[model samples]
Target chain A: MSVIILAVFAAVMILLLVGLTRALKSPSTGFARSFAVVAMVLLPSVWLLAMLVYADSEMKKVSFCTSCHEMKPYGESLHVDDDESLSASHYQNNRVDKTKACYVCHTEPGLLGYMDAKLRGLHDVRVHYFGKAPEELELVAPYDNAVCLKCHGEAKSFLEGGGHQYPDTLIDALKAGEMSCLDCHDLAHHLED
Target chain B: MVSPFQLFPTGPEATTRVLKRGVVAQILGILVLAGALFTKMPLLMVVIIPVGALLIALGILAWVWAVVWADAG
Candidate 1:
């Protein structure tokens, strides 16, 4: 898919060059004029917009995020078979879509959450390039409980689950930032001990 | 009345300069786009996308500007 996108971009570049050349050489009419006016100017703008949309969607895939060298461990953690491993359990048990696992779990709620995630992704890219890639990467902040509750909050299994049986205290603790689900459960990435 | 679309300016030298600038912009736009896509660097992408588009836009503008002032020759 990435290859296809690259090829399409390359083709557009070629077309732009060809059209520009034709306009420069020929008289201001006929094939040269029409191709220059339509193909050179308009087609590229449309093609670029399409490319941006395609790239954005492709970048959401788990494969895309894990492509970064520093992220491979986290990606590997998802495949861990141990039930205690939060991300592994979610992935192995089919709780999350494997293809979009990164985005599914990481993208926050509300209107700008996805955009915010994308911006953070860009920051990661910048860090990877400009800054020293961390020997051990950790989340800048702790994970939000709301992310977990976003799904499990309403589920009967979660509501009746052992630790969650006390809805008021547990839910309040989880929400008020007094407790983290990870305090008991294993961390999601399982990158380190 | 002058047609909106024209190609070669009466001063061929100036027309050549525009073409040269257009070509350079096109190359830069391609470089930015290809780098963003091949590397799949998200931060690089966020920066390059708008810049690449601007380069392409400039390339087109250079071509159009050249044509608008161009002679029928």
Candidate 2:
């Protein structure tokens, strides 16, 4: 997909260059004027839109998130040898798609959640470049149980687990958001402070 | 009696000026877009891409304006 976008961009750029040169050389020519309009206006608009789509897809990758220096520790933590680390366990065990591990866990479940995640990404970019990056990364809000339940809620292991069964209302509380999944399974990332 | 200039200014000079401005803007936009695409960095994605697109949009508008309001000849 990215390769295709790059190819299209290159083609448009070549066409644009040709059009501009011709138009500038002979502004009186009708063919040059028409070709210039198509090259400059139509081709570029389409290419820009395609680039946007490519960027959106690329941003979902784990590599993209870890590209920033501050995020390197978090990315490394995913590969930590500890089974107790939530991120590491999920990543190593293939619980989530490794390529999009960051996005899958961080983003909420619906369209609004997806948009919110993208907005937060923009904020992260702003802070990363314009503002001072904090020494420690933290979530803007408390981690929601809903994000966890989206996957584990229906699992038989989760439903019939002895620990959860011991306290019957525990599952209910977790479902109702009264209790957080992180309350017990808090080893989200084993970052070295 | 409505003058031709009053109805639609068909000056070749004005057309050339607008076309030049549009072409310059388009070139700048394409360069910026290419740079962003090459790097594929978050900063480029967040800041540069939109700015480049905006420049192109403005350029296109200018080109259209030149074509519609100014003399091609």
What are the TM-scores, per candidate, against the unseen true structure? 0.68, 0.78
Tens-place lDDT per residue, model 1, A23-112, is 667635578667666545675676567657766777888888888878888889888767778888898898988888888888777668
lDDT of 2 by residue, A27-112 (tens): 66898788877877888788777766766777899999999999999999998899999999999999999999999999988898
Which segments of candidate 1 are over 4 A away from where they belong?
A1-18, A25-34, A133-135, A153-156, A159-165, A172-179, A183-186, B1-20, B35-37, B40-51, B60-73
Q: Scoring only the second chain, what is candidate 1's TM-score?
A: 0.74
lDDT tens readout by residue for model 1, B1-73: 7654433345556665676687678668766766666655566667778887888788778767655555433
Candidate 2: residue B73 lDDT (0-100): 29
Top-lDDT candidate index: 2
Task: Report the error of model 2 at residue B4, Å.
Answer: 17
- Top DockQ prediction, candidate number: 2
lDDT of 1 at B33: 61
Which of the CAPRI classes, incorrect, acceptable, medium or high, describes model 2? Answer: acceptable
